[model samples]
Target: MAFEYAPAPESRSIVDIKPSYGLFIDGEFVDGHGSAFKSINPATEETLAEIAEADAADVDKAVKAARRAFRTWSRMPGKERSKYLYRIARIIQERSRELAVLESIDNGKPIKESRDVDVPIVAAHFFYYAGWADKLEYAGLGANPQPLGVAGQVIPWNFPLLMLAWKVAPALACGNTVVLKPAETTPLTALLFAEICQQADLPAGVVNIVTGAGDTGQAVVSHPDVDKVAFTGSTGVGKAIARAIAGSDKKATLELGGKAANIVFDDAAIDQAVEGIVGGIFFNQGHVCCAGSRLLVQESVADEVMAKLKRRMGTLRVGDPLDKNTDIGAINSAEQLARIRALAEIGEDEGAERWAPPCELPSAGFWFPPTVFTGVSQAHRIARDEVFGPVLSVLTFRTPSEAIEKANNTPYGLSAGVWTEKGSRILHMANELRAGVVWANTFNKFDPASPFGGYKESGYGREGGRQGLSAYLKAGA
Candidate 1:
């Protein structure tokens, strides 16, 4: 007999989400010229709050504010900036519970993930960049690298607050001011972060949050005053931003889409690989840009691995983002759910075998069962396209070279995983893989100190570590 678990829901009362939120520009909350939209909780389809949408004019206002603040912010001593970054990190830690709860409510991610993974890493990023703020002279860029005045940054919805940290922390540490736009679906946490900036007494215009859809983001990217542009989203949008800034002098770094391959060798421990596979594709409901959606198992161990993976998938609890025990949460929005469903149907129509564990989902929310498609071929759209949900496609490879060939066949080279106990095999596979970050025995792991980005369509430039600081600074200044 199996033991049934009771729902362990995190309380939402801790986060005081206002009835409506306005744009955060020049250290104050103000109304936007664009129309407002309601932020809905994906888990219940409940309207959470009214969010102000920023238009082109509002984005220009933000850029102007950042440009104005850049004069003083750039001149401020790095030691002073370090103090502010450190304070922000501490405050993120202090209010972590509130932020975690709010993140789950607004973003439809599991509470445990928001609490343990997202919020903690968000704070770590701030802390890591804070240390570098005063010591950038040794960053190896130059003896005196200078700030690239106002940055225009746009982050995606998948990892809302965390992505903001990836863009904002390093920019601020390098003495650049920024106007950031969080994704339309998940703008709440970024708005709350603006409050944290105020609490840290970060100077006016040092960081601005504009809430809106694509038009506002375009405005920020095309603004004459923004000296730098940083974006994390779909590959299509990344390309658009690249084109928009092509003839200009703006520095840009884009972290885009991925269809990572997780290769499992026959010599690998099947049980351990099963867990890693689950975490790789199912963590955050497979919304991760580097999710190991493609599983390349050695033919000898394919059956055993699939059996184990299926059994593990059966144990995943799906429902209620606020539930501590839930492994799979709601899709971030209705449109995203439609995309997932459409791709899944295409997989079926293309003759791939689809299987989902017996799991009951919430009736009202946007949800998808954890799905696995076996008999998937390289030509199948499901194998090539990013499902961006809790979906996995399984394929088989006989030899190490074949595994490498299959893995590198995709347009994306963001990340990949190799599972094996042999140290030499791991090193050899790592060298051959085209991915930017290759894990020997793990997947979906990230650290603030390590640099991350991708090759090919996965987008260019790094986002973390010392290398990331260069994107926000002028060389040899």
Candidate 2:
């Protein structure tokens, strides 16, 4: 069937983004001292908005506003804070469709995902954390379990709204004012979220948004008033942020890159394994931190598995992001597409055979075909690096031990998926795997309650569940 191009049913063009540049500080939009930069739609190359580039001064101003807000926000009773978070959650629900469309327009993610997965999960994060506001005493984060004051969060372009919720919800729930910088490629939803803050009547400076590239993020990390810094992005940038904050007393949590492994055993439910492998790499066009970029299959079942996987991949619909039926959308930005392509070339140069389903990609938009690399070795760049695209490197293993060895042979330990029929084997692998979020018989399964984060260079701390609250809590009885 040809890929469809139906408009998103709930989409409306109610918001106007004038050719303006500004900072969202103290509950209002104001000009940035820095020069203007264009934020283009990856799917069409349209300049959707010209966002204000944040310089060091803007970052400092935003941090100051957040520090001021923390005085009252951090001191407010837990019950009162809970109400505020709940209000934000309700407002997110009401304006979700608008936010979803904007996310697709700016980020080139399919409307189906932005609507079904991202938007709902973003709101659910707030709702789930909202209930925890007054209940932190029982969350097991030590004595008083108080706020960590002003937190500066830097999020990437992949899941703009969801990432914001992941960082902002917990901070607000624990009574921390936030200064968040959404990625330059996709700042629409975050800017839209600034409006949602007003709708929720969230206090001025409780949530301030600064928009820009790397230099601006550096400013946020180096700012003195930011007590804690949380970031979700590339390992390279995470390293820079870590280095920038090394001398300061400020605490930092990084949710960096990954080259996750999806291991399939011979006895696994082949159908479910096929689905898991497909979903693992294809979800959000594989622009996911925890994307299963590597697939390890038992040699006994490798041929059958690859055949089924090819058939499954052939059915995915990739095109316009606003289309309700799009399975894979355009790459988020030109820079990301270039990165994906460059790494794929490196895969070829490093001696791996690439295979992609015959599908038509958008001509004007930034697109990379969903690719699979065969004849892969543990040392192949495709197998080792975080490609951050819908590219899979397939490697066959003769034994369970070999599979584990190949899976762990990476600098990242963010997520992994295991497929097998044996419960003992599942438990054994789960215990052995070093990744933060492990999925058996499934891949890319996320929840507001499940704790999610990585080990090693893939970064530290957990995002959801009780562990999430710990990041925001101060030890005082």
Candidate 3:
């Protein structure tokens, strides 16, 4: 008999989402010049709130506001800025539960993840960067690294608030004012963050939240007075941003897409490697840029790993995002769900053996079951392309050299995993892997103190730790 779990849904009442939200500019909420758009709850396909869209004019106003605030913010003592950052961190902790619930409702990630992982890390990032706000001289950039002027930032929807924390915390810590555009589908948490900025008594215009789609993002990126640009999204857009600022003086840091490999050796702990593989590809419904979507296993142990992996996947609970027992939740949007479905079909068309555990999906809401494709080859589209969903492609390698060659064949170099008990092998693989971050016995782990970025199509520039601060600072200052 299968084990049954009682539903323990988290309460959403704590998050007092407004009926409509406006652009957050210069410490105020005001109407936008562009048309309004509705923010939907992916889990239930309900309209959560109407959001104001920032047009070119609105983005310019925000950029001008940030530019004006840069004069005072950049000139203020670093220690004073530290106080405000600390206050924001404290407030985030105080209201973490509300933020987590709101994140689940809007973003369709599990409540447990939003509660335990996302919100806590968001606060930790602020705390970590707060310490550096007063100590830039020791960052090894130079004697007195100076702030880049106003920064224009855009974040993706997959990990909405967390991505915002990654961009906003260090930029503020380094004394630059910002105009940030949150993804249109998941804008509530960022708007709430705007309120937190006000609650912390941060200076007017220091951090502005502009809500919109692609055109607004382009406006923010191409704005003349914006001195810096930071974006986390698709590699195609990252290229566009690079092109937009190619001849300009604007500094850019882009964290984009990936097709990471998770390699399991015959000597590895089978149970541990299976769990790592599941988490690597299924976490956040595989929306992560550095998700380990490709599985390369030694032929000697591939059968054991696949059998255990299929068993583990059979037990995954996919349903309401608010349910504490849910292991997986709804996909973020209809468009993303379509993309995942299309890719899964392509995997079948390419002669890959597809398998999904017997699971009943909700009648409503966007969702895809945890899926795996076997007998996939390096030449297959499923193996080469990023499905960006809860789909894993399995391939076998007979030797370590073959594994290394297969992993490095991808254009993306964001992250990869090596599973084995041998320390020397781990070290050797870490060195040989072309990924920006290589994990041993673990995957999808992140810390505010560790630097994270990628290479090639995955984009460039680090986002955490001391190196991250440099992205917002003028060189040789």
All candidates: TM-score: 0.99, 0.97, 0.99
RMSD (Cα, Å) of model 1: 0.7
* Model 3: lDDT to the true structure: 0.95
Give residue 93's lDDT in candidate 2 (0 to 100). 91
Clash count per candidate: 0, 0, 0
The residue-by-residue lDDT of candidate 3 on 364-389, one tens digit each, is 99999999999899999989988899
Residue 241 of model 3: what lDDT? Answer: 97
What local distance difference test score does each model get? Answer: 0.95, 0.89, 0.95
Name the regions of candidate 1 deviating beyond 4 angstroms: none
The superposed Cα distance between candidate 3 and the true structure at residue 30, in angstroms, equals 0.4
Off by over 4 Å in 3: none
Query: Candidate 1 local accuracy as lDDT?
Result: 0.95
lDDT of 1 by residue, 1-477 (tens): 555899899988899989999999999999999999999999999999999999998998898899899999999999999999999999999999999999999999999999999999999999999999989898887889899899999999999999999999999999999999999999999999999999999999999999999999999999988899999999999999999999999999999999999999999988989999999999999999999999999999999999999989999999999989999999999999999999999999999999999988879989999999999999999999999999999999999999999999999999999999999999999899999999878888999999999999999999999989889888775
